[model samples]
Target: MDDPLAWLDDTAQARQAAGLRRVLAPRDVVEPLVDLASNDYLGLARDARVIEGAVVATRTWGAGSTGSRLVTGTTRLHAELEEALAAFVGTAGALVFSSGYTANLGAVTALSGRGAVVVSDVAAHASLVDAARLSRARVVVARCSAPDEVDRHLAAAPETRRLVVTDGVDSVDGGLAPLAALHAVCRARGAVLLVDDAHGLGVRGPGGAGLVAEAGLAGEPDVVTTATLSKSLGSQGGVVLGSAAVIAHLVDAARAFIFDTGLAPGSVGAALTALGVLRDEPERVAALHRAAAAVAASARSAAPELGVADPTAAMVPVVLGEPDLAVAARDACAAAGLRAGCFRPPSVPEGTSRLRLTARADLSADDLALVDRVLGEVLPAVLGRTGVSAG
Candidate 1:
């Protein structure tokens, strides 16, 4: 009784010492700051059409989903969203989930089991790793961002039913997976390829369909894709898209799909509207890519010593070697009225903490200029004593 909670105190102290003390600061929606951290790639979160759709759907269907989809949760709105999403992404069918993380978990665990082997990229999102852990699958972590490693892993485990899982776009580094090659490897190994296109949808591919489509792997018989509505759709849910039979299996087998609360009508409506908007304005995707490239270019020009991976989508990471420096750089940006995302250990496999800057279609050139100025000032201080120069 004297020191029952002593371990908690020590853990907190250790985290604090390493500059990893996380905090929750609720932000004011209308704060005067340049935002470069949000996942709203298409900037439809506040669009009148998107907001109005949510409002109408909420007024018509109520606030919450009220029950699981198997109960009273499968609204007509959800059906419409599923249909639209499937068609948009070039898949035979789609099933919406509460969140992207849950979608990944549901898809992976349902598709893989004890006798199965999941050849996952070393740098996949935490959700996929968690899904693999829960599946009791023989999880093999291949090389970071290398499809060849996936092939090798599959080759080494020829007897197991295998699934090659990866993020279409690396959330931290903004690098794209070699999805076409990965799919080829999967095909050669008779494995299934599951791509989590959370950061790819509404930012890449034809009319922002996704990276799987961009790589010409969409609708492939052995390929499955998962995406989040929260990112570019400006909504709050996730979807798994694949062949009709695969989706049907998920409906019957996935616990998350069967037991979890369905996506609310409002989110379903918003996502549907966002998809329409994306179709009507394909240029938005192009703008997002351009903005991301511009930001990456600026970072490279201003701080060449900083490892700024070339962005294939809206995500851009400015690599800071240490967690303490990353936090300091992020704070410096915040102080200068710029909001940026910070990524550290566990989230990044490289063990190099970074400032993750995400570009939105709504971010003007002026906003990017502010990002440049803030980083120019903060990066130097963060990289102290090295006296680094831009390449």
Candidate 2:
């Protein structure tokens, strides 16, 4: 009999021909390059205090959660992390999930069902897109950053239950969504609002509380926020923060939360510790914003034609508009002793492949200078330009 998976080989061949095949390049425990690719904005992933928190939690709670959260997976550390997150972000309650992706899945699926409508931004993250697909609601795609468009979609929906979902910040370009405007639109329609603050938490808002709080929407009965501990917190997990009723509803109804094992104790402990650090040392948040601005400014100065935008968060993109050029630019960066993330099709819209540079709170002037030096070498080759000086 013919192989049942032969079609997959054909698809792989098609991807390879189109320059879209993806491969993992895992880093060593001790990397030699200056990493501008990771999402660790606070630079706390390697901090001694954070490490100690993880170590103590592992010693006390063991290595694994071992069961779904509804069972034995719920630990004291989990509850502590949830409480700290809710309090930190100014929410009435919080729930922890194994990952940011699962948190989005749980929030979207649990809140919207057969008789509901989910109006999502066109530029939402992949996890949110998948969540919308799984929601079983009539999904409406509205233009990114356009609250008026969202209003029209919500007004036209036949379903009485409406949930408007959006990312607090666009992951690729690092531009903020119009949260207050969207919230107003949702409120006018008596709809619930969910903001995925994956990129906004620990980087935007007061004391790194998140964008929902920054926009003065925190603790609002109609609003809910989801965030990832892996990004700014330098840990691994996700959280959903909202009213007590929403938290209780998710606990009973969210399949992603009910069926998946809870977040590991070490991650929960580390996140809790990270929250304390943020509360005490809020300067780290400001430092991160400055770093992002420096990175974007340097990139723009080197190649004025590249049209790099000022970042509203920790990310800056150098759009190359083709997959091969993006891959080549990334390789050039690697050769210059710097690491940059490459974004191609699906991660970004077609014809907008680019380099994604992230900033860390710990980056110094010398580090920014090094980035300038590396980009000066790489930009000319990718952009076909001359006189792109390092200084």
Candidate 3:
């Protein structure tokens, strides 16, 4: 007789053979190394002010949210964050969720259903992909090479309600989507545009208002936006911004929002504090952009054969064809006193494994110098290519 879990071994063995196995390697709290893997773009995760905000909230409220938002989890802090997020993003209203992943689910599913059509970009994040699959709508994936593919898909879909989903800045190569053009297509086709601005908020646009605001699409009746507080905000929650009507609909109909527990008081307070910090220090956004450009330039210099381009946001991908080479590159970075992210199959495509480096506004000259040295030493040998130089 076969064991009930016999398939697990087969899957594990297949993954190991393909070099797609993953393992956790947690870092020390007080390590003497520079971090280029995390999404803390503003470096406010450890800010004293943000920490105090969390501490005060936990002391006053409880550690957990206690219940769902419709129940006892709706605190004054949550209300405050919602209002501030709406105002900053130039939307009519906002709703807070336990996490960005759930927020995307709530937005995509609630906005589309049976007899509806959902169009998604080829390079959308995994959360968005999962959301589209669960939405129960007719899904159409737009081709990445063709700019007019999404518009054509929207035009060809039946007269049912259409929802177009895309990322403001793609999480993989850090390339920016043509939001203004897409918005025009949506407007013409009587479809709504939903942008996941997780990578764009607090890094792109003026004063970090995000790509929607940058394109003058914020507060538009046909546009909806979702973002995470965990990235640039240095907090731990997600938000959805749209018209008042859309907000009301999600609160009433979204299963993800209705069933999920509310965001904790500490996370709400921390996000509120971080938003305040962003408002007060807009210069940090500029610094972050400069750093992203610097890192991308360095990557291109180190491996011109890779054809790396300047990133539109904080993510810089150093493409290595095979998974083993990508892992080796990451290990080399760690040995050189740096922390870089390793992206393998599933996170990226099968053949395009890469080292994903994120930029923080607080990186110093020494940090960049270290990056140059590490890449110069690792890229040439691991990649086995010429024209490799350190920045």
Candidate 4:
């Protein structure tokens, strides 16, 4: 062993030199700061009903599912959640997984194989990218997020099964995908379409039904959708929705689902209760949009030249060209009693490092003002350091 561990040090140093190293900051269970960093979009994480659902389920089911769903995992509660999700999203069937990542891995790999060609959107979430790579199909990256690129790729592919993969909402820049047009192209090309609606679920569409339902594409025979419960439903699980045939195919072939432990019993109960809450109080969805709109307006007013865009799905990104500057901006926000998401390389492009500001329905007027005040003071400094402005 001639300095075997030295390579790791070298790699770490290189990452540090490029300002791409990451560090974690733990927080209290109850921090006084306003949160614009977490994925709890509808502010349901701490809801009394959601919490009660989790507690009751946990006490009944003993915390975790005993095994994979095929074994000892499936329960009466799981069936209920799946049925509720399918009905909400207008799908004929649904499957629950341990996480969104595994849902993608299972969906993509099970849907497309050696004889199929998978055309993927370049801006898709990393999970979708990984799933595409693992699909064992000839993976082709679309030229852009536009439907034309996907259509062109499918049109040029061989006379084999075709699958088109994209995201409903871009995770970084918060841009929306043209789901309707993309679906049209898929239909014309006789290709199955897969939309990872992780960012769009529980935020977009009527009463938070999701982007697929919003575009009137839900329940389409050739369409499949995946989403996580962690973001909006304020729980931990992933779900796949589509026709019964597709669900059966995944249940039989998706290794990720077959091999991994089932989702926690608590999460399933919380998600089920949260879904009911959303159905009863759909106004939470509207409140979420109002919060996002308020945050976007503040970002614009803070640094017009910084060029922050409107939130497409409850996310506002203020791009800073340098990793170090983005870190500095994050630190400034933290010091100002505001917690925002800081994204660097790998999460975003090299020059597009940014503060990812997420909106929650619970964000009050005072919280919004704090965000506005903090960004007003912080972004200008970021712009100045990057030579976009003078401090």
Candidate 5:
């Protein structure tokens, strides 16, 4: 008989031919390179206090949550985290989920149904896109940077209930969404606005509350926010912040939350400690922006035509517009003792593959100087092959 999975080989060959074959290249425990690829913006992933918190939680609550949250997983730490997050973000309540993806799923699906319409940002993360698909609602796409177009979509929808969803920060290109303007449009159209501020938490807004709060939209009746603890907080899990009614509804209606196991106890503890650290050291947020700007400036210096945007968060994307050129540039950086993110198709639009460099608040001046020197060498060589002139 023919192999049942023989089609997989054909698909793999197709991917290989297109320069889209991916390899799982795990790093060594002690990589002696300047890191610009990780999402640990605050450098708290391995902080002494954060580690101690994890240890204490593990000792107190064991390794796993043991059950779904509704059954037996709602530990005191979870409750405390929920309350603290709501308070921090200026929301009436908060609900925690196992991951940011799940949080987005829960928030979108619970808030939208057959009669409701969902307007999603074109450049949003996959989580939001999948959430809109799973919502079983009519989905429309609009440019998140263009609030007027979103408003037009909402105005045209016949559904009485409408939802507008977008990222607080564009994950791939690191562009800040127009949160305030989007909220205004949603308000005018009698629609609800959901902002997934996964990249904004612990990196933007007052005391690192997030971009929703920074835009002065926090606690607004029609606005909801979702965020993750894995990035700037240097932990794991996700949370949804909104009115008390929304939180209660999600608890009852969100399948992702009701069916999935709760977030691990250690992650909850580590996140709590990280929150405390962020509260005490808000200046870390400023340091993070400085590092990102420095990286962007360096990348731009090498290929001025790359048009690297000034980042408001901890990410700087160097768009090379070709998958092989981007991969080559990333490898060249690795050879120069630097680790940069290689983003390609699906993560970004076709022909816009690039390097996504993240910044850490603790990156030293010497570290930045190294980035400047390395990008100055790596980007020009790669851009040359792409025929992108080095202005």
Candidate 6:
């Protein structure tokens, strides 16, 4: 008992030595900086309309959702959001959760069990991996799919009841999963394909329907999709979309849904409004893709050896090869009044760290130029490349 708490100090010291200690500093308001770190791809987070909707809902419904959804939490706002979300993503039904993480937890655990096997990509999001862990299913890590790797995994595990789980877009590298091919593999094996479209909703597919829709798998009986409203939708919450029977099963069986409080009324209202915005302004999705591609191209031109992948959506990761340098580059961008994300060690599976930049629809050509300038100046120093000059 006397020494039980001493290990905490030792662990903290170890993290500090490795430069991996994390801390929180809450911002009071927007700082005078160009932000590339945020996941607000549609730039609607602070939009007047979205904010107004939230305000109206708060006034009408009171602050919280009140209690668990099964009790007194369900409201008309929540119902409306679910209906709109299901229709938007081309699903027969949808169920909302407190966050995208919880949505993944619910979908994965509910759909599969000890008798099932979850074939997941090596690079799937942390939430999905955690869901697989909690599922009590045999999880097989498949090599990140090209167009054929998924089929290979399915073939190898032919006798098992399988569920193929993959990110619609790889979060760190911004590469897309081959959903159409993966869906075909699942179909051939009589398995279910679950695509987590957290980064793809309101950014990819027709009318911002998401990646599953883009691959023509949205209405397929063997496919399911999950997404975050906090990203391109500019709201707060998550949803699982699939066949009516699947959603009905989750409503009764998913522990995250049964135990967690319903999404706040304000978030439901904001999400509903954002969906309407997407319906009327489909061009915003195109703008986001264009911005991401432009950023990737600019970074490649500045550092020909950086190996910037052409983004399939709004995220772009500029590889830096080492962890300490990635953090240094991120700090330099912050110092230059441009904020970008740094990914290292556990956050990235490949052991190569990177600067994860998210392109927003509101970021202008001038903003992109500033990003290029900051990185060109900072990256060489961070990467320890002596003679390279800033562009």
All candidates: TM-score: 0.96, 0.97, 0.97, 0.98, 0.98, 0.95
Off by over 4 Å in 2: 385-391
Model 3 residue-pair collision total: 0
Residue pairs with clashing backbones, model 4: none
| Cα misplacement distance, residue 106 of candidate 2 (Å) | 0.4
lDDT of each: 0.88, 0.91, 0.90, 0.89, 0.92, 0.86
| True-vs-predicted CA distance for residue 190, candidate 2, Å | 1.3
Relative to the true structure, candidate 3 reaches a TM of 0.97
lDDT of 1 at 282: 97
* lDDT tens digits, residue span 238-330, model 2: 999999999999999999999999888899888888888888999999999999998998898877788888888999999987888888999
Error at 271, model 1, angstroms? 0.9
Error of 6 at 283 (Å): 1.2
- Per-residue lDDT of 1-391 in model 6, one digit per residue for the tens? 5987899999999878776777775765959789899899999999889999899999999899999989988998898898988888899999999999999999999999888889888888999999999999988898647537767767777446789898997787777888888787788877899999998899889988988898898878778899999999899999999999999999998999999999999998898888899899999998998888888887777676777788888988888766776778888889998888888778975458788999998889889889778777777666555354534
Cα lDDT of model 4 by residue, 1-391, tens digit: 5987889999999999988887767888989789999999999999999999999999999789999999999989999999999999899999999999999999999999898999888877899899989888999998446788788888899957998888888877778888899999999999999998988888889889999999999999999999999989999999999999999999999999999999989999999999999889889889998999899888889888777777778899988778888888888899888898989988887788889999998888899999889888888877776567732
Cα lDDT tens digits for candidate 5, 133-233: 99999999999699999989998999998999999987877778989899889999999999999999988899889999999999998999999999988
Candidate 2 — worst ten consecutive residues by lDDT sum?
382-391
Model 1 lDDT, full chain set: 0.88
Model 4 RMSD in Å is 1.3
Per-residue lDDT tens digits for candidate 1, residues 1-391, read 5988889999999989887778998989799888888899999999999999999999999998999988999998999899999999999999999999999999999999889998887888999999999999888988636767777788889455888899998887777888888888889989999999999999889999998999998888799999999999999999999999999999988998899999889998899999999999999998998888888887887688776777878988887777887888888889998988998876764458888999999889798888788877777776773455444
Better of 4 and 6 by TM-score: 4
- Provide the lDDT at 38 for model 1: 88
The residue ranges of model 4 lying beyond 4 angstroms of the native Cα positions read none
